[model samples]
Target: SWELLQKKVFQNKSCLSELYDVSLEVAKRCKGLPLVVILVAGIIKKKMEESWWHEVKDAIYSYLGESEEYSRGTVHLSYDNLPDYLKPCLLYMGMFPEDHNISASNLINLWIAEGFVQDVESGRLEEAAEGYLMDLISSNVIMVSKGGRYNGKVKYSQVHDIVLHFCLERSREEKFMLAVKGNYSNFRLSDWKESRVSFSFSDGLSEIASKTRKPFHQHLRSLRMTLIKGEVSNWSAFRQFSKLRLLKVLNLSSHRVGRLSSAALQALIHLKYLAVSARKFNFHPESHLPHIETLIVLCPFSRTVLPPIFWKMKTLRHVEINDVVFDLKNNKKWISEESSKLENLRILKQVAIKIGADDNVDVLLRRCPNLQELEIGILCDEDSVEICQLESLTQLQILRLSIDSFQLNVSKLRLPLHIKKLVLRGTRIESIVSSIGGLPSLEYLQLVLPTFIQLKEWCLGDVTFHKLKLLKLECLNISRWDASEESFPLLERLVIKKGHELEEIPLSFADIQTLKQIKLVQCKNKSLKASALKIKEEAEAIGGSDIIDLIVKDKGFEDAKKIITALKGKGISATEAAGFCWG
Candidate 1:
């Protein structure tokens, strides 16, 4: 509690030495309850006055008098103290299921769709929503469940049971949203007057459709049906949603459902956010959703062909479709049109662009010039279609390129200067690793090459990855790696997967002060494992303790036990000796 208070409130400010006693007293008043301590700290962090601290201490003391309801009182006080703008955001958390780890991106998008996040000085709603999330996180109202593997940014977040309960109660009081869990039979349609409604039950849509013969809620703006189990076989049930003319947000992407008919969505002219899963998707956004800002189509069964009108949606900010093909051949005239530019588009993922002789991806990329994250697969076998125009996308930060059966000649590839994360699959980069290393803003680089075409030798002779933090090499045949600490001065994590032919990691990596974790997966080389162990030993010898983590994984469970036993014979603890496997 004291540490958290110091970090969040004091921020290691030595000038606040006089408040140490008062802060300790305040922390002690919470009785070691983490949430209460965090709430108290968040309340007092705004003011540095000694009198204010004392007042906060007394206020917490008053809550402590109610021993049975102390936690609830403290939480309620915190909620009451929240700023008006943030109250709705907090209450919105109840819309998700209990114990559900919500995606930060999805939550922010929802907040944006719900008009909870107001415009900030930067004019980006996403940034403002992120600030709100961080504020809640700092206050301990929200918990960071998981972070991104490469960037370490919060990917998943969840609220505690107490907080969730509080949010649900407050939401009910405010009539903000209705969350339907378990059977839909208990749900009363007349009682649901809230603008937003979320269903966490099976066959929720069918039940509601069958119950309501007419348009039930014309005032409803958002509706989400999260199927926990079983697929919705009745595709016709979706036609019932057409009555919701004012619906702004609709999500039914949890389970496999039938193709959403255009007629069902034709009446949803006010829809801004749409997420649906289907075997085949033929919904035309240009004709149907004129105001759609976020569109997500999940088709895991087969590749869905996106219509040419997909590129013409001007209001789209985020587009994510899995296993989808874009037939840009017929869309050439549409691309050449001056008004086809998607200036608001920020994210485009898992989109396979079919490049032919007459059309190139450059023409398409020129339309969406402001894309921040792009994951595209070049579906072409000809060598003429090369990714040479990515440098024009100066705003791009994350890029994943997959060129199937095509060698990505790095010499010809001109990457964006500001890209922070780059993942290349089915591409050859053995000859020109220096070109990629020269990226000034790159922090994470993952190379997952095909088995038949392996990177033989990667020698970092004179090049330096100045800002690189994580380097992942998978399915590579490189046997010799000539690198020093100078090569990757800021690298923290090293991951090698299926590197069967690689001899060992360079001993010089042990000397890199910033190195923290070295993970080897299915790499049968005993010498490579020994090299990682030696790095740990050397790091401990120099740094005075075990500062580095070594995780090794093979294919066999028994071999992992044997390796753990062997490591235990050494000074390694059981926790540190885990995660080893053998092929």
Candidate 2:
């Protein structure tokens, strides 16, 4: 009660943050001053009532005693007497929306635009905004999620949930929204049956898809049906949809959809993102869906053939599938005009296969002049010249190769010179660095053993790559690291495998200046501590903490604590982290 009275008195007196609950404007009067917090909380509790708050504010007018100015309590008075006008300048923080993430740059620009900054001070607006935001934060009117400010502009600030709740209670008295729980029902709005509807069927099953025929007559622009238990709602089994303009985004994943029939898919000209799988059926080409940008058809080893008409989807940006077998053995087949028209394709993202048939995949790949990312499966069972030539994919950004263990000459796989991210699975690393030196823009590279294969000898000891930023090696049983890359100047994250046999940490990592994170799993190498220590020493010299996060999986809390203490004893801080397990 005393604190609340003081808050009222401060407001009436035009004081600084001496009140219990500090106002947003006055809290930043000091640099995270601790006194502001206790006083603000204390005063707020006493003035929790609405009438009291009004009286507190109204007293400002009465307390001035005929003068135009009055005390703003302790918070404002301290603010008014600041070395610079920024005390009040910082308190007027209404430019940013409540709960909005205010960027340091953004705050500086706003302050500059408002002409509230003195030009002589270096980082003038940013420094002032920083002091202001910090004051508000320390006083509990705001919070700082990100510890540091970006671009040296403004201090990060967030409102508390309780404060937001108070505002919400007052502001949302007339506006409120409540979400109804449970799966979408077959019982839909009868008035808009012809219109497209977004439906969720993750819980077991719902008869909505099956019955879209009976009561549905609207043109569906999109239909996303995912997380269902079984096959796609056998709507085709009942009746063919009128015109697929009736659908756009059709996602029937984790379900058993035999096929997207040719006739049923004819009129879907406006389709964009389609995620469906025919585990035991084939894709029948019907019409071209020009609007489709993302297509995913994950299928196991089966007879589900891709429709030849898929060549007409010129705007395709993403393709994610487990496996694909292109059979071009028909000697009497003919190529249509659409087969040569692949110029608009920008992405053919991911592909997996057990066997690749003898088809002109070269001619097929040549059509997408803007291809950016590709994941090819080396499933050349009977075919030798599988991936012929992809020199045309100049815009290729990411390439992943998931190959079977038996396939040899893994080095034959090639990529565009400016690729960004490359991942290799079930492949040997003979001249990994040299062979990959052609990639000028490569930022990330991941090499993992798919099926318990030991990494015998990867002469990565003699090559140099100037642009590799991230290197991830997992699940490969190796005893040593003979890597000799010219200090990956921008490498950031290094993740070692869990439950793998590794004798020591890579000594090559000792010189990388930009290295930021290193995660160790089940395998703790003999040099792990030394490597961590070196990183700590380097980070501190560079004015930052290298050991930001440490996760010790499959270790007891006590043992984890011991390991952490040992590291901290070595001057490298460590913490035990927990992962969320969803049932």
**Model 1 C-alpha lDDT versus the unseen true structure:** 0.79
Global lDDT of each candidate: 0.79, 0.50
Query: What clash count goes with each model?
Result: 3, 37
| Residue 549 accuracy (lDDT) in model 2 | 38
Reference-based TM-score of each model: 0.90, 0.59
Please report how far candidate 1 places residue 258 from its true position, in Å: 2.7
lDDT of 1 by residue, 1-583 (tens): 7776777686766538778789888878888777777777778876888888898888888785554367777778778778889889898888888889999999988888888887575337778888899888876678899997767788999997888888887777788888888888888887877888888876766777677755465658888877765544343467676678889898877756766544467778888899888877775645657788888988777777766676666788888988777667777788878798888888999988765566667888888898899998877656554554688798999999887755544457788899999998887675547788889999999989733333456777888899999999898867877789999999999999988778778989989999999999998776677667777777877899889988878656356657776887887754467434322
Q: Which candidate's TM-score is highest?
A: 1
TM-score of 1: 0.90
Q: Give the alpha carbon lDDT tens digit for every residue of 42-118 in model 2.
A: 33334445455444344332333211122223233333333454432333332223455645433443344334556
With candidate 1 superimposed using the best TM-score fit, by how many Å does residue 6's alpha carbon deviate from the native? 4.7
